[model samples]
Target chain A: MSLKPTPVSRASPNRAGATLDAFLRWREASIIVVAILLTIYFQAVNENFLTSANLETVSQFIAASAIIACGEVMLLICGEIDLSVGQVFALAPFLMHFGTNAGLPIIVAILLALVACGLIGAINGFITVKLRVPSFVTTLGTLYILNGVTLTLSHGSPVETGGSEAMGNFLGASPYAEILWAFAAVAVMHYVLRQTRWGLHTIATGGNLIGAAEAGINVARIKIGNFVLTSVLGGLTGILEAHRIGSIDPLAGGTTVMFLAVAAGVIGGTPLAGGSGTIIGALVGAIVLGVLRDGFTLQGINAYTFDIIIGAAILLAMISNIHLGRLRRGGGR
Target chain B: MASALRADNIVKRFGSVTALDGVSMHVEPGEILGILGDNGAGKSTLMKILTGYQSPTSGTLQVHGQDVVLRSVDHARSLGIECVYQDLALVGGLSVAHNMFLNREKLRRFPPGMLDNGEMRRRARQVLEDIGVNIPSVDLEVERLSGGQRQAIAVARAVSSDARILLLDEPLAAMGAREAALIIDLVLRLKARGNLSIIMIMHNYGQTLDIADRIMLMQRGTVTYEKAAAETSVPELMDIVRREYRAVRSA
Candidate 1:
């Protein structure tokens, strides 16, 4: 046999060309462009869309959706979902109420509520992973159970909670507190997803479970960790929403909010099929959702029309992203 | 010279089924040992035992001629034993660099748990280059690569992790002629590079002879015949298999 080097192409010879390819291949780039266009379109349609007072409403929408989407993105990348997260959201404020009534400080009560949410997430993970149930089924079961528990515990009615003004302002009553929390979630979660070993393992676990296991990754730990993360975020969203409204409602952040958070994630390029996702993209996706809702309301479009638009828009964005990805790879299955 | 890996008197049973019975094999340093067998020939079971995916019921394993027991896949890997299964274990959604690093990503010291992706990419490229495997970019996801390229990456990953005893399970099972040639070339290159011992559990007789220095034939959970690849002919191996089939039928 003749000893000769097999001719194989080295890393793309042209640096600039490689950079262009990476930019095109990045799922977030196109989504960002779409988000910007939507924001501009909304600002144009109604001057009130960007007004400080109206912006507060938009920020609230973006904040809640983005925070939940951030958590869901991690779970989605690892091929799990928590339909119960919204229910956890409703249960948290009530948990805090119970804790405060039990003589705990308001901050301690809130922490306790978050911890309870994390435990719920752990249970979700345990049931799904150990019981061999598909996460969709497991979380779906927990969703209704938690909702029922919240309603039963709350006596099927909304109640107001009295906390210090500073605590109220710190939580969500301030004009931009929730949005600030959302940005922090996006920033830190983005780091965890992209820059940490946990994030890489999560992607690998989702991409191929057996392969990840073969590589000695603790697959159960990664999945369970993500579940806890998502649930904690859900509980926090609930607490923030409650404080923002100065009332704890048994029906807060129900299926509607859960679906919106998931929609934000899916729109931001995290396929429900798993394997890959982006926190920053999810944040922008939430912004897109917020702008559409706020913009449509300002234009006197009814809520029903808004739903139709959102559904169609998500489908369109996802379809385009898929096709564009294929095109970027020069086409093929 | 000490064998890179030695499995002595290995036996495995799974609840009333004897998957492997009294199987023994060894590969010397820098040697490619091919285990050719038909389906249910205990090839996979032996490979599993060798890779620590399973422990033999009664056999002992030696790495670098030192007696040791492999507790798990991670244990086997730490002992410089890596298996590239038929599935290749490449996560298609990940970039080439990420798949190469997988569970063993390099982390930044100061940030505490943050990946040093730049360093990883650099090392990934260096390793791939050292192995003489090349592609368009390390940033490209594994799914975009052809089957052969993906296989090459899996092998390169093993090599990068410093695997001394590499097991290739059905490395050529589903590949087309060109892709098979690509892997054959890769195995040959790794052999020429020295210090890495390979045991290929394969099906094709001629391909095995071409790539391996020695061949061991297994049938019904035991090695039926063994010979230097240079001395063995395809007809001779086929004749042995036919004789075994005839004996089984007569029994």
Candidate 2:
């Protein structure tokens, strides 16, 4: 007996410019197009835009945000968000600094710092899942609490992270080192989100919580795991930045970076509503923000105007994402 | 014939209200037991208890004559009991193959937790084909499929999971005639296998008479009638429902 394959009704139209039309139809593909176009436009507009030094600076600026965004993408896909990641990002390095100052081994201090962040994540998960509080409210409260702790510990002052030279070299010897960490995070997380049972479960939990539970999936565990993952990545980003800069600034990585990371994830292709997301899209989103900021600076654009442009760009990307999503669903209105 | 499942004197209470009162039933291997009831007749509650979604407030459940304690949905599934719920419980954004695998995903040999996507897709295709569901692609997200197709996938998921006993809650509700016929055919084919038992909750008495070997009717948390389909008539079932409605109204 011959089994015939059924043809997909909504296959892309076989017409002129089909490749371009297909690219325009997909959210991730369109974002890549915009990123490439922005890069070319910036390079053409400024003589120093494409220089290795400027490119390195751009990468350094994006590295920490990209790492945080990778984690946020997972949390968002799982139907939660962490406003406290920025506070955790700022506080982790301070913990590491104090630990090393107290004669603890550098590696031990880093682990201790990560453990502290993980604890915060667990608290966030506990409140959100077990206590029945919305994650938005729980993370908001933690954000304030963690920020206050960082400020009180540092006396609102910058402190030097007097780590061993070897630790510093391994963590933040060059600007490229931070980029490597970011890419490594992207690769690992991308694989986990796409190729693993945990990843599928996360998507299922976020997609339909009750359905996942009925399917015998431990929804609570998936949510808690994602929260811990997000916090740990934020903590790692903090530790890397402190090692590179050689100092812990209590005000560094404030809520601004948290918002930027979320924006980057959404812009890259992950919906804020949960159920669907991508890590590579988030990486590109960070790069897009980086290119925009670097380009604006090179063009001598005003800082306030840059903020407005970024905000507008985010809104535009979101609208396009929604529209394209509808288009894919048989062009439903 | 050996009984596949037996629920004896099950009682369930939700705080101040009793949802089920001493409900007892048995399903034989290869037999389709049709449960007919009104909106709040405790059919769904009984099904939930049987599938381990909710434990009975008091009672015992037996599988293949062995007394068992159902701790969770997974526990029930381990005992070879599966339920296809009315809500369908499908993740709309996931591909058909992904939904088929859901919590029971197959993993790659080397990487451990990594999903074996190629194998799952192949198996999902084969399963759907065996069930004779005409789906365009297993790669399509379930939300993209028509209503009948969605129902087919949900039923197919339960059928292909090595279930010895299947509980279907309103499996044909809100489906078109063609779609309903398709599900009926699948159910009959599974019955022919002789290794599985089915308990179907239905609102339509005629369809139940067409497919069920035995019919059980419930009204207001109690079993009001039970009879072999061959001996019972639709008029008799309606008379039982009318009498129950009168009793409910008088009380």
Q: Which candidate is the best by TM-score?
A: 2
Query: Candidate 1: TM-score?
Result: 0.93
The lowest-lDDT stretch of 10 consecutive residues in candidate 1 chain A is A1-10
Please provide, for model 1 over A292-331, each residue's C-alpha lDDT reduced to its tens digit, 9 standing for 90 to 100: 8988999999999999999997998799778876766663
lDDT of 2 at B169: 93
Per residue, candidate 2 scores C-alpha lDDT tens digits across A4-39 of 233433444677556656666565886888899999
Which runs of model 2 end up more than 4 angstroms from their true locations?
A1-27, A331-333
Error of 1 at A274 (Å): 1.0
What are the per-residue Cα lDDT tens digits for candidate 2 across B75-173? 999999999999888999899999999999988898888899999999999998887776767888887777678878888899878899999999999
Residue-by-residue lDDT tens digits, candidate 1, B1-251: 89999989898999899989998889999999999988999999998888888888988999998999999999999999999988888888888899999889998997999899999999999988888887767887788887788888899898898889999999998889878997899899999888999999999999999999999999989998999999999999999989998998999
